[model samples]
Target: MRLADVVLPDSAVCSAAVDVAETYASPALLNHSFRSYTWAAAYGTAQGLAFDPELLFVAALLHDIGLVAEFDSHTVPFEVAGGSVAWVFAAGAGWSRDRRRRVSEVVVRHMGTEVDPAQDPEGFLLARATGVDITGRNVDDFPAGFRAEVLQRYPRLGLVEEFVRCFEDQAKRKPDSSAAAAIGNDLAARMARNPLERPE
Candidate 1:
């Protein structure tokens, strides 16, 4: 399925998620959040995966929220803090406790190495989509025309620089966090060479 064929969910919670993302996220990050959903939705549709659009949309919009200064955690990892933020947002949205927990789990899982789609399709989709957006992994999975469409709708701005800087700050503050581990693994260098930024 093509990204253009997917309809963005417009539930009340979905609207609130966009507002929150725009309020706290940088221009680059805000667009990243929107693009992430588009990527995941398109991927899921193409794979014939069964997933909840609302849940995935909310999770994608708020997944990197902890990277923002407004919500950055001093002790826990950014993804951990972001998960809490999602939990609170879900609570305020009147989602059931289980669904709230699911959102939180999805946020944290987005940072993990891998997730099985059968167990958690939203988490799997979010992880893959974020990888594509941030690291340009699996870019060829989407047709070139569709990738251009997504980039046109939600421009990258300076997401690579801005996101790497955020993770650097997070690593310094939370040495044991995932950001720290990623730094040690040369995440910045890899992201610098991302194909999305130097497409030929």
Candidate 2:
């Protein structure tokens, strides 16, 4: 997939997601978000899957918005918080109620252990793409050339360290949050072994 061939939607909903995500997130998170969308879209294209590109784009871009200070939630997990933010953003962009709900569903489900593609097309692809970006899982699922194209356009930018740090902060702030659990559980080890991890 050539970077030039990728087409992001021009709607206000999509545009707002891109702008808010980029503005709120750090360089690492922003790059990861973009890569997530690219990988998911590329995978959809490869699999002959039909999806709402605009919906997927907004979901992917805002998936991690909760990690940023402005959107952090005090009680619920970051995923839910992020989902709510996306939902509201979509509504403000004039998305239909169903479409906005889909955005929330995708954002919330992206962090789940698995997302059934039949049940949630956007969520399924988002999780798969996130796995590749964050953990190097299933890197070979996409064509090497396609992956190369995406990485070239949006490099890792030290994502592992940055994400780990962000998760650590989330853990400290909300000891019972899912982010905290991930940290306690093999987060450090997983990050250490991440194929995407770059040497300092």
Candidate 3:
């Protein structure tokens, strides 16, 4: 499904974020990123921490919004690129410092699995919500601290299982793997270039 289909409408908080994020991110990249984040949110919901699906989803969508303002080289680090976007979006949204900090942390640690439990709880939660095992394989490889935090903070949104199952079914109908790999590589390279950090 498309971003409009997956994103919730009730919360203006996240909807606004999506609007800003999509305005800057390439259409293809936005679509792919949204799908990935949606899948993760579904997984998290299924695992029992029922976070505000819209909140998490919006955060994921705009995680890289900084790229738009920081568009310099093509190899900008993800954390730096994403940080720029978070700073701008948070400022525009008038979010508190804590909220901005949380968004920044999520953007930086979303890809890597080596999250520090205490220092990066939001990052840890995003990882859990996205279903990436810290060990990079078995779901059981997730750290106890991360898992416990998710359970405590997010509870269960009740729609995650359905979302995950639907995503699984959709993945089965995809085309050749090579094309997917190529697309992923291209996107990664583009993201690395710091697209979100461009001056507005």
- Which regions of candidate 1 deviate over 4 angstroms? none
TM-score of 2: 0.91
**Each model's backbone clash number:** 0, 0, 23
Q: Which lDDT tens digits does candidate 1 get at residues 26-120?
A: 99999999989999999999989999999999999999999888898798999999999999999999999999999999999999998999999
Better of 2 and 3 by lDDT: 2
lDDT of 3 by residue, 1-200 (tens): 22223334356667776776667766644643454464465454445644545435656776545334344223445444665677567767787787776776677676565766456544655665343311122334334444444333323332233323322332333323222332444433432332121211
Candidate 3: misplaced stretches above 4 Å? 1-9, 50-55, 66-76, 116-122, 128-200
Please give the CA lDDT of all the candidate structures: 0.91, 0.84, 0.48
Alpha-carbon error at 32 in model 1, in Å? 0.8
Tens digit per residue, CA lDDT, model 2, 1-200? 56667777788777778889878998889889999998888888878878889899999999999888898987888999999999899889888999889999999998888888888888999989888788777777766676777777888887878889888988998998878988998687787786555422
* Candidate 3 weakest lDDT stretch, 10 residues: 191-200
- lDDT, candidate 2, residue 162? 86
How far in Å is the alpha carbon of 111 misplaced in model 3? 2.4
Ranking by TM-score: 1, 2, 3
Which 10-residue window of candidate 2 scores lowest in summed lDDT?
Answer: 191-200
TM-score of each: 0.97, 0.91, 0.53
